[model samples]
Target: MELTVGPNQFFWPAEKWSAFYRDLAEAPVDRVVLGELVCSKRLPFYQDCIPEALAALTEAGKEAVLTSLALVTLNRERKLTADLAAMGVTVEVNDLTALAHLPKGLGFHVGPLVNVYNEGTLAWLASLGAKRICLPPEMPLASVETLARAGAGLGVAIEVWGHGRLPLAISGRCYHARLHKRTKDNCQFACEDDPDGLEVRTLDGQPFMAMNGVQTLSDSYACADYQIEALAAVGVAALRLSPQSQGFFRLCQSYRERLNGTSPAGTIASEVLRRLPGTRLSDGFLTGPSGVSWSAAPAIP
Candidate 1:
């Protein structure tokens, strides 16, 4: 299976963002998704860097795709989405509203942010020139298997959230701003401090969730260690690894080694959290009854 780096989900500084893509172009990854996926307001700060990054990835022989914002409510966001289709690269639709702006027969990509819970949505998206889909993190293995089977017949490639801080929810208000007692407009980009995200503790002081602007993610990084074989058996095209603040190039190399049969998933799993610190790994969303269950190695079937 290929390692496709998902979009950066955090609000990073412009130089850091630029540097990440530069390093990514040299990583052992097959695809690199570049663009802002969380907040549309943060886009302008690093928008100019996209063209250069896109060129770098393409020049390095990687398949690059532009990701639409997960939530697009304003006119500027709508315009941005409209302009994305004209960039000459494949568009990865995180929001369904993007489909309205995409041209017919162009074969756009579906990101994990879209609510593709069942086969019907998969088939419908496939019919609309969707070439590939990264299934939502909440889907169980049973549903993934079924969708992968249906996708094969539709000539569409299926991918899953192989690794990342599971994006649990999105809201209109910026939680980071609220935490700092500031409005979204005047809040000075406070979310950039935590490259991954600020951990949200429970009432009992458990690391329950993470806050990044308007997006809420799981405190644990979602790792699909034991399910790779099952995913491959069901004809999965690739495994997505989300970009973290540090050790991401090394992270990509590890996943590449795992796919090539030279590295153990356990070792790679251990290496990832070593650099990112204070986060557990979970495959429960793929195997357990709920998204919060913690399992190191989950039963695929």
Candidate 2:
């Protein structure tokens, strides 16, 4: 399976954002989806850098895609969604509303945020010119296999969430602003402080989830290390890796090595813990009774 880098879910400064994509041009990933996916408010900070980043990735032979906002609410947001097509790249529709804005017969891609739970939904999307789809992280292996088989027959590539923190939900309310005792409108870019998102804890102090503006993410990164073979065997087309602030270039290389048969299962998870101490890894959503369960033995503490 090939590797695909999903859009950055956290907010970062314009220079840092440009640098990340510049570095990605050399990474082993085959496709890169970039744009503001979480909050529209965060777009202005780094919007200008998109063209240069897209050019760099395109020049490096990577399939570059622009993503529609996950939650499009206002009239201006609708206008923004409508304008994505003008960028001259494939638009990955995270919100179905974005689909309505696209010109008829224009080919596009579908992101994980769109609910594509069954064959009918998959077929309909394909009919609507969806050339590829990255399945939601919470989907089980059985469902993925089914979708992969369906996608193959329909001529649509299927991708799975191979790595990064699981995106649990997106809300209209900004959690970061709420934490700072500020309303969403009046709040100064609070989510910008945590480049990788602020980790939320339980009352007992256990890492529970992460807060990035209106998005809620799992505290543990979802590593598909153990299930790579199983997914590939089922005809999966690609693995989507979400962007992280630390060691991401190395992370892409590690997954590339694994896919190239030079690295073994569990190596990715181990390397992740080594690079970011105390980082939990999970594959339970792909195989499990719980979303946070890890498959590898002697789980990293």
Candidate 3:
């Protein structure tokens, strides 16, 4: 299985955003999906850097893809989705609305945000020129196995969410703006403060979820360290790694080594805790009692 770096889900300065992709050019990932996946308001600040970033990744021999917004509501956003096809790179659709804007017979990819639950849905997307699909992070292993088998038959590559905080949901309202008592339009870019997202805590003070503009993410990073072998054995083509603010280059190397059988299982989770103290790891969506449950022993605090 190859490592596919998903787009950065959090807001950052334009320079930091450009630098991340510049550094990513040297990382061991096979392909990358880059562009705004959350609020469309964040696009203007860094959209100009996309060409440079895409050029760097492609020149370095990585397959570069552009992603449509996860929740496209405005007319401009629809125009943005329609314009993605003209970029000369594969478009990864996160929302079904994007499909309407893409040209007929144009090959595209599907991101994890799209609800691809069963064989029927997989087959339908395959018929729509979907060359590859990253299944939703919340899907269980049995379903993934079934879809992977179906994808193989349909000549489509199937990918699984291998790492990063699970994207739970996306909403129309901006959580970051509401937190600052501002409306979604006049929020003044509050989400940019937290590069990885602002972690939301429960009433009892436990880390519960993270807020990235309108996107809701799991507090614990989802690690497929233990399920890598199982996913690959079932014909998964790639493992999607969501970008984080810290140690991401190293994280890509770790996943690459793990896929190559050079690094053992549990090493990735351990390394995450070492670098980001208090961070938790979960694989329960794949092997589950609950989504937040961890498959390995708890990391030492």
Candidate 4:
């Protein structure tokens, strides 16, 4: 399956952001989705550097797609989505609100954050010019296989969340603000401190969730190392790798190697465990009762 790096989910510095794309240009990946998918306010900080990063990735013969904001409420955000059409790049719609602003008959992409559950929704979106779809991470394998089959008939490529922390929910409340006892409007940028996201634990200190400014993710990264064949067997077009602050480009290369059968699944899992330190991997969404279960043994290759 092809690999497409999702937009960075954290508030990393501009130089780090640019450097990640620079590294990705040389990485063995087919596509890259770049742009801020979280809070719209964070865009202005590094907006100037996106064009150079886009150019670099294109020059490397990689297909780059721009991502619209996951939550768009303000006029500025609406304008941002509208202006994306003029960027002359493929736009990945993270929110349905963006479709309202898109110019007529322009093809767009559907990001994983958008709700594309049933065949009806999928068909409707394909009619609206969605050439590709990254199904929501929360979807079960049965739903995924069904969607993948239907998508193929519609001439739409279907992708799935292959790895990374599960983005469970997005909220209007800025948790970083609540943690520091500040309101959303006047709060300082507290989320910048946690590059991966601030870990939230239960009362007993068991890690449960991760909190970004307005996004909530699972503490453990969702991995599909063992289920690659299962997904690929059912016609999944690609796998999306969400960008983390550390060792992300290496992470992409590892997956690429594993997909090509040049490396083992355990090798990729071990590579992640080596770098992240005690970070658990889950494929429950694709194989278990829920989106948090792990397999005890590797699936047969």
What lDDT tens digits, residue by residue, belong to model 1 across residues 1-301? 8889999999988998999999999999999898989998788899999999999999999999999999998899999999999999999999999999998889899999898888899889988999899999888888889998988999888899988898888898999999999999887999988899999998998888999999999988888866777778778889999988878788788777788888765867778667766668888778876776756646568
Candidate 2 TM-score, true structure as reference: 0.98
Q: List the residue pairs that clash in candidate 3.
A: none
Stronger candidate by TM-score (3 vs 4): 3
Q: What digit string (tens of lDDT, one per residue) describes model 3 on residues 25-45?
A: 999999999999998899999
Q: Tell me how far the alpha carbon of residue 8 in candidate 3 is from the true structure, in angstroms, after superposition.
A: 0.8
Instruction: List candidate 4 stretches off by more than 4 Å.
Output: 297-301
Weakest 10 consecutive residues, lDDT, candidate 2?
292-301
Q: How do the predictions measure up, each by TM-score?
A: 0.95, 0.98, 0.98, 0.97
**Over 4 Å off in model 1, which ranges?**
297-301
Query: What's the lDDT for all of these models?
Result: 0.88, 0.94, 0.93, 0.90
What is the C-alpha RMSD, rounded to one decimal, of candidate 4?
2.3
Residue pairs with backbone atoms closer than 3 Å in model 2 (clashes): none
Q: Residue-wise lDDT of candidate 2 within 1-301, one digit each (tens)?
A: 8999999999999999999999999999999999999999989999999999999999999999999999999998999999999988999999999989888999999999999999999999999999999999999999999999999999999999999988889999999999999999977999989988899999999889998999999999999999999999998999999999999999999999999999989889889988789888889988877899999745556
lDDT of 4 by residue, 172-246 (tens): 889999999999986588888999999899999898989999999998898888788889999999999998888
Clashes of each: 0, 0, 0, 0
Candidate 2 deviant stretches above 4 angstroms: 297-301
